[model samples]
Target: MSDGDPADDIMTATYRALCTHGYADLTMQDIADESSKSKAALHYHYDSKHDLLCAFLEYLYDRFVERTSDPAGADPAAQLRSLVQTVLDKPEDDREAFETAVLEIRAQAPYEPGFRERLTRFDDYLAGEFERLLEAGIDDGVVDPAVDPADTATFLVTMLTGAATERVTAGRSVECTRRMLAEYVESHLLTDATEAQL
Candidate 1:
């Protein structure tokens, strides 16, 4: 939907409702309540809850892509930091609730081809971004040439998603996880040679 479209408004409302009521308890009425419009207006845009949810999923995916799309320049370490910060820098309560809702949607991916496709694409997009930064770092001699960019990218993505999942499921502190990731980057991804040069 276009930026100013009613569908967009409905979808935004759906996000708020999901954050508040969650996927299991989310209703059209609840979504409408969160929006600036009425239930009838929401129904006018979305024929069914499933239809609206699919649109909501698309909106979320697009937002994620937008957030993670570009690294800005040739600084791979900075690129990595930006990506990690974007994921973990949310305010505490909001971040937890948002992660919980996303996990709920993520668990449905297997049963829903639409979800599975979007999630898979998003994963690949992230992995590719990691690979790009790693390769750049190697080329710049900051990352060890011995490290395989492809393999390291995979590991990085796993670490990222794992940290996020841990926060959601176990209520782990975001700052703690963020520090661990930063340390992991320092110890593994950035070489002693790189540090010495710095």
Candidate 2:
């Protein structure tokens, strides 16, 4: 809205700077240097780093929703597999910085209400996805009837996000985690009826 998407440019620049310097070390000048926007334009759009970072965090979650939504007509169990694989896939060198940046943003959630709001919304995306998948699986007779959709949804998100946290913070082996998740999903989440049928 303000002068030919300068805000977008600034946000893009901010993202680059964020991945490079991380949240703690990133500076306005760094963002400015990365952007085509002038320093004044950057200031006009975001007066402070916290404001910019909150926007950045929101931007990331929004991008995730846009990119990761399961394909239409995919089986619910397959959708669940896709979701698990998406989170559990091993980190590529290029993504390490961005993944680290996401965790850095997550650490701010407890203290910053605005940041917390965006994070909650981001979580809703996963939770909602889990709910839909759980419903579909139940309807299709793939997931166990005894499993409560809401509880399982929470559990799936927790497992996925916990894996993400470990990947960034503790250098967890994603291959190991993915194998464990697949086994757990098969043995626990998926219905015995489906297994017997197979």
Candidate 3:
């Protein structure tokens, strides 16, 4: 664990710097300076900017998993809402960093096998999680039985991505996304019978 600490610290520092500086302006020296670690030390762990970025993505996913798994007692819809809200409500500085990193990695993913794999894994995991939640919602009668789990999951994930993109690019706040999603659930997922019960 002690050995892992520095690497974690480096990843955290790198993420913060990326969020603040964005990908175009980000540099190894910036990471080193922000992290307060020697350039040699940073190099000792990651050989290149790409490697560090890949690690950063991994770190973010790990955090995402932990956050999702920690809370219990809520139904699937509530859990999903919580997940979206968590992402939406992330500290602005951190959100900017994450967006910058993802955009940078996405741009280079075509040429980098490892980065592409990491990106694919992240997307797959998110989609899978949504599928599970949709299934649960169906079982609980909270979601429409006729809704295709895979298709609905894909749609919800797409909506989330669009909302996040808007938040990042158009200066839109998450409240807009939240309102839209709530309306979407009420209109599409919850049946008239269920609506009457609520």
Among the numbered candidates, top TM-score falls to 2
Higher-scoring candidate on lDDT, 2 or 3:
2
**TM-score (all chains, Cα) for each model:** 0.81, 0.86, 0.82
Question: Model 2, range 60-139, lDDT digits (tens) per residue?
Answer: 67667765686343578777877777655543433678678767877888998888999988778888888888888999
Residue range 1-198, candidate 1, lDDT tens digits? 236767677777787888888777778999999888988987887887777888777777787787677845447777776777776555333545656887888898889877777777767888898888889888887776777889877887787788778878997766776777777777788664233211
Q: In model 2, which regions exceed 4 Å deviation? A: 1-5, 90-94, 192-198
Compare candidates 1 and 2 on TM-score and give the better one.
2
Model 3 lowest lDDT segment of ten: 189-198
C-alpha RMSD of each candidate structure in angstroms = 3.5, 3.7, 3.5
Task: Order the candidates by TM-score, highest first.
Answer: 2, 3, 1
How many residue pairs of model 1 clash at the backbone? Answer: 0
lDDT for 165 (candidate 2): 86
Q: Tell me the whole-model lDDT of each prediction, alpha carbons only.
A: 0.75, 0.75, 0.72
User: TM-score of the candidate numbered 3?
Assistant: 0.82
Pairs of residues clashing in candidate 2: none
